[model samples]
Target chain A: MSTYRVVPAGSVFDRFAKHIFILPGLGVLVALVIYPTYYLIRLALSNFDLTFMTKPVFIGLGNFIQILSDTYFWGALGNTLVMASIAVALEFVFGLGMALLLNEDLRGGRIIKSLLIVPMMIPPVVVGLNFKLIFDQFGPLNDLLQRLGVSCVDWLGNPLMAKVSVILADVWQWSSFMFIIFLAGLQAIPQYLYDSAKVDGASGWRTFRFITWPMLVPSATVALTFRVMDALKIFDVVYMVTSGGPSFSTEVLSLYIYRTGFRFGTLGYASAVAVIMLILLTAIIEVIIKETRLGKRLEWE
Target chain B: MKVKSKYVKHCLHYMLICSALVFYLFPIYWLIITSLKFPGDVTASPVVWFTTKLTLDNYRLLFGHTGALWGAKQYVGRSFLPSIAPYITNSIMIGVLSSGFGLLLGALLAYGIVRFRIGGSRLYNWLLSLRMIPPVVVAIPMFTVFRTLGLIDTWWAVASAHLLMSIPFSTLLLIGFFSDIPGDIMEAALLDGCTNLGAFSRVVLPLAAPGLVAVFIIAFLTSWNELLIANVLTTTAKAQTFPVYTTSFAQVERGTAWGPAAAGGVIGMVPMLISSFYIQRYLVRGLTMGAVKE
Candidate 1:
């Protein structure tokens, strides 16, 4: 029998060597995450009976209930869901459309394809700043709308328009991502698909329904799941554009947590909000990825 | 009959393409027109207003100068060229260093995990779960940690913070890339008397070059455009990135300057556009990994 055994007799020595490479990253994760996360939970759950900073009275789940019932929290959640659903849904449709379009045999198509991706490259803050300026009453959008004799609606002031503005801005930036993925998916679809569909005399819409939709579902699922997850956590534009203002009409869950924790010095309450949001975002993302064929299928046309 | 059907499909396809173009192109046109006009015309004229003086003032202010918006003048200097120079340098340095170092680390960690099977497959998957938490959730906790580490207000601090997100991304990308390489080649290399590391560096790395470039560009963009944790971690101009520098254009007292901010926005698009021009093939290949593996 070989003297060099699997466990190597010295178990600790073997284990340590086995994972020598994993250490540096794991160590950093500990420093950056584990300790602070511990402190965050501690700060949230422990009651400072003596002083805000002082020693311990344990009040379990008090903060959780407080936040759960809080009107502001509910309002933020509602706003967040609306934006996420609208944004994700629209991006899916637009992305699918672009993907299909780019699939066509067009001339100099590559140049336009490249131009389409430029919006996604700009920084989010610059995006927010640019859109904010553009949405202003005197901004070009209003200027053009007025020239056409249409009413110049307040793009960022009204609650519905604010949500629409933020969602539209996001769609502009990320539709390209959706486009890119769908293009890849469409190409992967064996060309025999069309040849056979043609043999059967299926109409364009019918071929798409039978071939494209079924095959493209996985990519569509991915694009939808990704955008939905990301949209839940929107903060930047809502912050710079409206500051979730005109009396909190635009506030989302992430923005609310920021205001409560950093702005209001309610660290304990804010931590509770953060924990809830973390759980919610992960759970929703998991459900979407699982329920849809996104994670399970490689049928992929 | 088939040819006639194809003709109709082409017509429908062109219509769909036009609508998509209209949706994508309109906002960019709006952005350009707004940036060109003077501040006075911005509010006074209804949509599609023209600038009496179509000035490059916004671009000039972003490059350097003040009162155009983001007020680089008071801090960087009065000069138009050097005022925004520090922010430009910092953005470039931080973006390049973090991306370069991240690719190196991602390669090593990916190799260790994939080849050695150092931990369970579940553990590898769990490592990727870290990114799903979203940056906003982790921002405060990281801010506290970076503060404690005395990493606040340095390029290293921002870069390290970026690693929290990028490492997972690059590592997962690598896993997919590695999985695409034929196992038989690796085994053959081993039989040919090459050590594990030797085969990895020689065979696996080259095969995955397209993937590496794609992941590197993606990683570079992630760090370059990140602003949330960046806003808190870096206090001064020396540490601030491009996004933060552009924020200085939001001056309320003088009313926000569109020109400089828009100019800065346009400048920020350079790295991404220029990158796409050359490495376009590598990018799509990188993004569509495992999706098309033979």
Candidate 2:
């Protein structure tokens, strides 16, 4: 039983000692993240196309000019925004509905919740493949349609339907995610509020409108912020299912950047595309965080 | 009449849940059924709902057992890329390596921020914002940087890229969890003459072990499910992960091979499905990054 000795609290060494703890993480973060991001911004400003050179030549926003002029850039950006909004909207509706239903006191509720979340947990590529199988011209989706006395639709081949298919697959894969978040939000509402509402003779819809909806706002905003950011970065499912195909109809920003960078080896131009995405991503996040009042809430917390 | 109406409402509620369940479950069910079906039955028109005759040919092909399936047995030896076993191994290795690095550095950073109150909420917010930085933004520059360093196509390079992902996530999560940890315990440890590092390792670490496990799972799964970095980074099976390998089957020149690809899809998804059941609560908490707690 050796007696323990305490280190001095306000010693000069303590100040420097904190930096030791900070350095390991800070070093890696700087090396792997900060430097790379810095390099990316620099590369974005250069004629850094790997196909043409061993070293990136500084061109001072030539790549940005190129990106602005490129028709595909605008197309891809429009597609990304559309896909994100459509998928997120559908997911919210379906997810909120399911969350409400699941919130009820029901038999095997936990099991059902777990099963529902399976889609969200599976790999995106696998989700893409499963949807591809389902939407095959001769597949079960068409089979179900035919059985309903409807003509079979070419779900992935037709341009409009292909976009719909991509969104459908995204919704299928993530609505459960929204469901879980909404369920958590719903559950987090104190039972006493409902009890007080009941004592006030508040009707079901009115209670929901006055009490539940407001209570859910925080979680809803959090969920939507996460969903929108994730949806905007849609790449895996698109790459897996359509490869941004039927003539680039589903070519979202990430997929187009990936094609431009990797396949064509135009790293400079691709970096420019990525920098724009990064800016947009930052702006979207900033807006959402502010609009949701989440930043303030977080600060107070 | 009142009781009957209430019963009918309950029935409708159950029906709605059941329909949602089917819509969610059918694709998974289809993948499994398709994986079990023979190659010929996979693309069979008027879609075979169920099959009486199932074959393991897809799984066999996945395991490089193509001696009899293809007439030229020699082609079997060269069938390296499509082999499912290595891809699974690669995925597991990358997942483990990335998570290991991620959790180590993340836990350390989180402890520093929490105990030292370094930068306070601002630091935490800055770290969380790092997560919003799209991987595509850094991918190309990172690619060129790694290429210069001669780390391109290496497992370490891929793991390092994924490490960037997991750090912010785990750090943010642990910060939330650490805030919940009673501060008096750390003060007690400090007064007991344990150094700050000692307090973290012996005191806070044991308390936060479950959270670390949860973060590891999240980090591992995120890395496991990623395709773009793996696709761009690794050119060969040596470092390419399961998602990247499985993706090749979807875009094969000969046309998509439905049966084997379905088998791979089933195989790829199984581990996640199994792990998800155990992590459901942790997952929700992690998914929100402790932004909205349960």
Candidate 3:
């Protein structure tokens, strides 16, 4: 019985040995994360401009008050929500369709599946640059449209089209990510469930709705949460393609913070915006976790 | 009747798959072809779908060996333009070091969590939340701190920032891999008179090699492709990455030099393209933060 015990109980060295494995990693992570976060909070509460050589001037809640009155901040916040929702919704639909199609176990499926991963694997900056070329005035897309007797529309120049183009680029790159996740979910489903469903003579749609859909909830939650989180921080694509576009119609919150802090030299106000963004993200994700009961599923045994 | 119906369904599935592939592959195809085209052919009307006149002038221009005088002259006064070689070197150096360090730490942390149950679910949740924090939020303060330490524009500044981003993600990923390894193996090693560190290195690390590879690739790629933190931390070619250099084309005032930019984009995408093929099996597991294991 004593030999069967895995947790050592003999010596002081044995008692403290476990901490050795974790302390180095966790210590580095904590040290790296804690200081910036602390400084970020401190900067958020002060007036620290990069352009000025003077020390920060502490101002209580002033930046937050200014944020409340700033229409640009509100517009950027609105754009972030709208873009994330629309792009994620489209990605979910297209990804699910792709997953279902690929799940059929057709001939040459492996090749097609590997090819599908290409867009998602490439850098977001490259995706943006690729789309920028394709959306150019005389590029392939416009030529194709013109050949089809449709007019060539300005893609990045017009504000509405710029938003549409950004969403399109995002969907093009990320739909494959959702597809991969859903496909994994689909594969994880036991074949016996379908076998039993077939014995009962259930229709395909009914089997999917009752069996597949319910089984797929966990994967859907993960894909949606990650995609939404990533879409909210959509600076690279927008930075390359539109740079917040023709009259700032596509300036999402992350890009807004970048412009404020780096471009315009207003570190304190940008830090305030960033703090707000962090809180909003945490709150939204918490609601999502609670609503989906993902927290329950994420627990360790 | 059932056989015919199955045939029709197969046809429908093939059609859908083909169309989706076309939608996904066309832009990539365009990017590659544009890189091979001359400036005139790139913007040519009718889209120049097939040009026998494909040129590597863009590549030559990017490598700074353009024998074409005009291409050389176009970039003569552009001091801000980055030479592609040094930036690529910087990216590789930073990516390898940061992700390497991230893997070492993450593996140990994951091992501790799986075996000792040190932090449990609460700690796991905190790590997950750390992964969710926006890069911009971290970028501002990291910039300030690095500057104060006089570490700005060095590889260390960018690599350390990237390490912060990679650690949580790598730990989360490695946790799934470590959990899959049965505890009996560790117990067996311990019963053989091995210390915890010895058992971890000799027995566990070998078993987790595939997972470690996958995590390293993903972490390296994340650092390689990252722009916001890297952009904030490094200003000169001394430590800037390929993505930062690629973005400079977008900022070129006279209008983007699409040919050279496309060439650079193609170069930047090659490693990931090759890596995707190698890691296809592990990608779903890695990308979802190990939530959905295949």
| Residue B142 error, candidate 2, Å | 0.9
User: Model 3, stretches more than 4 Å misplaced?
Assistant: A1-15, A298-300, B1-7, B69-81, B253-256
C-alpha RMSD in Å of predicted model 3 compared with the true structure: 2.3
The CA lDDT at B290 in model 3 is 76
lDDT of 1 at B206: 98
Q: Which residue segments of model 2 deviate by more than 4 Å?
A: A1-16, A296-301, B66-81, B253-256
DockQ-better candidate, 1 vs 3:
3
Candidates 1 and 3 compared: the better one by TM-score is 3
Clashes of 2: 0
Clashing residue pairs in candidate 2 (N, C-alpha, C atoms within 3 angstroms): none
**What lDDT is obtained when candidate 1 is compared to the true structure?**
0.70
Give the docking tier of candidate 2.
medium
Candidate 1 is graded, for docking, as acceptable
- Candidate 3 docking classification: medium
Best by lDDT: 3
Candidate 1 deviant stretches above 4 angstroms: A1-18, A46-59, A292-301, B1-12, B32-55, B65-82, B118-121, B250-255, B282-294
- The Cα error of candidate 3 at residue A230, in Å, is 0.9
lDDT for position A201 in model 1: 99
